[model samples]
Target: MQGLDEQPVQAHNIDGFVFLYSEAQQKRYLSSRKNLLGHERVLEQAMESGYRTLLPLQFGLVIHDWESVREQLTVPKENDLKQLFAKLEGYREVSVKVLWDQSSELEQLMQENAALQAERDRLEGKNLSMDQIVKIGQAIERAIAARKQAIIGAIQETLNPLAIEVIENDPLGEDMIYNTAYLIPWDTEPHFSEQVEALDRQFDSRLRIRYNHLTAPFNFAQLS
Candidate 1:
């Protein structure tokens, strides 16, 4: 029979071999001084109980014939396995610790979200108030009316003839008018300008004439 430390023996070619623990046999060879002769005796007894040699590699001891090994090897009962229970307890403790940390973080986020929602609700409430909304709408209407009046006055003042036909007026403002246009005779423009200048002096602040180029009513020849 070849021993385990006898130069890495192949199990299929060997008639029989004794498996030894590398822990017990510190040496790599069967003939070395560190070879455990006492453990070899124990392994021989185990092999007689129907245990068969299996291939050995890098990992820990692997022997076939489990039933024979079970009968020969002494192991603790399930109730007396303290090390297994301790490992499971440690895993449970770590899992609980992780879950607790996650729960605290979730709660803090929920609280912050709730505060932001409350602030949003307050702003929405202010925006939806009937009085506030009505006031804003009224202000906008007034501004639009003022702008329209200004545009009409500008158009009326810029056109020649000083006779602006008023189409619309603002009910709220006295001088504000809308859609006014001017009409002037094409030949009388120079004379009309002298009269307009005199009128402008008379009512400089009250009435202002603005002139714009209009298409001549009819083209007139120069009277030389």
Candidate 2:
């Protein structure tokens, strides 16, 4: 297999388990996006090579030798590894990110709340103090946060049934309503996708849902 440096990655069998690896400087893995993607490609290739079940190491892990790898997989821990493989068998992850138009949502909020409208009217065309502006900004921030929580809750309620496990990742920015990864059986993907499509249609004007399907179960398979 070709790895981060496009060098040969050899496979070693240790107690009935296979470890595919390539020798490289640790700094290479930390260098750039290209190396990161290349590392991920190596893992994807390993899984695609008729070994459907895989537990990925933490990114940038540099085990110096075969003995280190062997020691990491030995004895009682080996049973745990096998159980993890069995648990993840026939499963993949689907990642979904929901983004909302902030300006649009704020406009809707402004139209809906009479008190907020009155507050805005009070401050309009006035030479305001910095304290007054800061308070107004804080109120707007709170309003945005509350709306995001409600929408995200509704999304999770709709999609949770189809997934074996749902992981809520930290939202990246102000416009992101939620970022989540779902662990699901391969057979259930069609139904899961249909639900996502239905949601997209439901919120088409205000929100955009980004759905990525059939990805490796990285979120679910974190190892120390």
Q: Tell me the tens digit of each residue's lDDT in model 1 across 1-224.
A: 33444432222311122334333233233443344443343344433443422222222244554454434431322233233333222111000000012233333434655754354445564546777567555654554456444544443454333432212222223332332223333344455456545645653454434432322111111111
For model 2, the stretches where C-alpha displacement exceeds 4 angstroms are 25-28, 48-50, 128-135
Query: Would you estimate the TM-scores of all the predictions?
Result: 0.23, 0.85
In order, what lDDT does every prediction score? Answer: 0.35, 0.82
Residue 130 CA error for candidate 1 (Å)?
Answer: 1.1
Q: Estimate the TM-score for candidate 1.
A: 0.23
Which model scores highest in TM-score? Answer: 2
Alpha-carbon lDDT of model 2: 0.82
Please, what are the lDDT tens digits per residue for candidate 2 over residues 138-181? Answer: 99889878988888877888899888899999988988878999
In candidate 2, the residue pairs with backbone N, CA or C atoms under 3 Å apart (3 or more residues apart, or in different chains) clash, namely none
- Name the lDDT of candidate 1: 0.35
* Steric clashes per prediction: 4, 0
